[model samples]
Target chain A: MGKYYKTTPWVIPELPQSLKNIFKKNGKKISIRKNQVISGNDETALFSNTEKLIYIDSGLLGQAYKTYCVNKPYAMSIVLPGRMVNYLHYLEIDNSGDIILALRKSDIFTMTKSQFDGITEKDLKDEMVRYCKKAVTSDFDAMCCMFTCDTPQRLAYFLKALAESFYDDISTMPLVEIPLKLSYAEMSYIMHTTIRTIERLLPKWRSMGYISTRRNSLIIYK
Target chain B: MGKYYKTTPWVIPELPQSLKNIFKKNGKKISIRKNQVISGNDETALFSNTEKLIYIDSGLLGQAYKTYCVNKPYAMSIVLPGRMVNYLHYLEIDNSGDIILALRKSDIFTMTKSQFDGITEKDLKDEMVRYCKKAVTSDFDAMCCMFTCDTPQRLAYFLKALAESFYDDISTMPLVEIPLKLSYAEMSYIMHTTIRTIERLLPKWRSMGYISTRRNSLIIYK
Candidate 1:
């Protein structure tokens, strides 16, 4: 599992050279442990960092949701490497109970709000808008899938999306490999079903030759 | 019900005078009929205009979702007067089957994409970013409520949020009124439940003094 846990570096296609230089110079890199709460709840009181932009260097991260009745926190909006996070919170739009969490041992990079403010270049601003737009689209896509699909189709869609996030050339891959170790309990929470349901479904899927598991990873055949 | 169909004008608090002047000069006001599809699906093919920003001047609007399995369209993320819309589509972020629709007879003001691009003022750009961030926050809040809350709580939360969008000052209101006419079927679709379930719950809610319906409007006692 560790051998498969490769972190892809962040790269925005067609990014202007000047903006890339600024990002390279100012962004600070950091490492986090698996299952760490990055932002929200009690962690928010200690969260005084001034970073405005967050780039995932490697590993899985997701939005940790705090519900009124649920004791354990559940995660959704799972993010992959080479993607960005925290633009909404940094902009002060989302002040709700949702928190960012590390799904696995991860590497991340950050850019301060002030650093973002200092950039007056039109091209850079346009690029940032494009990136933010992509994040919003992804949110809507996940919301649509959750609302429309059944548990099995939802699980399959989520797994395929996760695989696509990791695979740069998904068109050529024979077997899509998901590196993160997601438990049946977590899947149940994400899919809004019981753990018993997920446990019952996994073996059935395996028998159909649609999916298989090894160690902490899942592989879906194309 | 007809008397309650009032359209409020767009107003962003503490907006700069200079930017306001630009908006006043460039924005074009228009009206749309109830149940009109504003964007997405077949409407996208007919969409030829280049408007970049849509400010709800009066009436209700929502994201009309078309699913693969469902025959009827469902709506969520309901927008009210004084709120902004179309930034995601204008930025080309959302291109799925979700369409923006007029929930009631609606009046809106739009600024062309070129007109928006013409403004190089930093304050206006910041203001636009702030508006977009608010929309994103609303999406996240709705998603969290849907995932976490039970059916009754979810319906209550949705109604309260809808009222807040119409209220001038939620802090001072004893009873908040939702001005839109949402059918039980529509509510069921948005809540991911059956219309029978909504019918069963409404009378119980009215008896509890939490909510009451008059004609087409819903009044929520705070």
Candidate 2:
């Protein structure tokens, strides 16, 4: 077993008063309740206690805070609303039935009763199960592939994923500011340790050049 | 200042043979003499040891082996033969005379003879100098404006630069393994500190669910 050692972070020490003043003028604070979902697909910015460009706090059921929300890949059935058309609607008879049932209930359906009665949920569920199993397998493979990857390899992969989500040219994209929305307590929860343990680890990673933290902002190393 | 403490990496008492195989199969033994140029654009893979995926050794003049070659940016004037194009390029011009001279020497001319002859080194150099000063200033302002960046930010920047030279997205592209060619000594020199440090730190990150490492592979918590 390798020995574990603590190291001090390399800090610039004492920021100029001007820099402090700038933060005071621009910084804002927000408080998120336990179990409160900070940002979702429709949400943009959310303020959190302690000022930062971004902050995430997990109060319960997960990491307290300080986790990066990278884009997660989904299966074909998980079509983006208003963005892509779902082929599964036509592929699964049961799902088509749900659509017809809803339409009929709304008193807007023109289809004959026979047309609406032909759908079955069993086939739709079976396809969905298969898709979900495939998704799990894909995730497993991805994790395994990353198992041997170095920091540079991991960073490149993260960047590529972000590029696909943001609609940008990955090759030319500049380094972007990734927001952290987790607090120390939340991070401890996710780490499955005490807050004290997290407090200890933070500075070590800082010193090792893996991450940078300011007031509330934590910038992940590329 | 934040308190810094390092956590010992958690070691599994018995690693699965499948996982251990990664380390066993990829490691190679080799060495690079001091001041030796490990690899260049024209050379084969960057490392000298081609047999193993992982080469760990020791030597001097490591910096020479560290350089990476990337495609030049759009305004391909000052970009070294290889380096990621940072925002810095857009803001500065260190020299223009060399560009003008090179242009004059090239048989593949894009400008009219009169226009080509009108170009002068002094004009080019002056423009570049002006651009450079502005770029440096802009870089600082941008840092302060966008985020309260610090040393970790700087380190991440450095790593990214280093990675640009080494990282290749082989998964999506046609690849016959990586042409990874590193001497055992060179590879060891590159990772000696990191491996020890990471080995010590892995347990903490694992506890936090941030990373998982076994033998030759590492899985990053997304």
Considering every candidate listed, which one attains the maximal TM-score?
A: 1
Q: What is the DockQ of each candidate?
A: 0.37, 0.01
All models: lDDT? Answer: 0.62, 0.26
Model 2: residues with Cα > 4 Å off, grouped in runs: A1-15, A23-222, B1-33, B36-169, B172-174, B193-222
How many residue pairs collide in each prediction? 0, 37
Sliding window of 10 residues with minimal summed lDDT for model 2 chain A: A1-10
Residues B1-222, model 1: lDDT tens digits: 011112111112222455445555677777888877765565533242234466666787776555454643454666666666665554455555556777789987777666776764776777766656555555655665565567897787677556645665666788887766789877886776788889999989899998888887888887
* Model 1, docking class: acceptable
lDDT (Cα, tens digit) per residue for candidate 2, span B1-222: 001101000100122233223333433323433333332222433332211122112221222111111221111111111111111222211111111111111111021212322443555434433433333332222222111222233222322222222334222433122122333233222232233443444456569875444553334433
Candidate 1 chain A minimal-lDDT segment of 10 residues = A1-10
Candidate 1, what DockQ? 0.37
Where does model 2 sit among the CAPRI classes?
incorrect
Q: What share of the true interface contacts does each candidate keep?
A: 0.54, 0.00
Proportion of the native interface contacts kept in model 2: 0.00
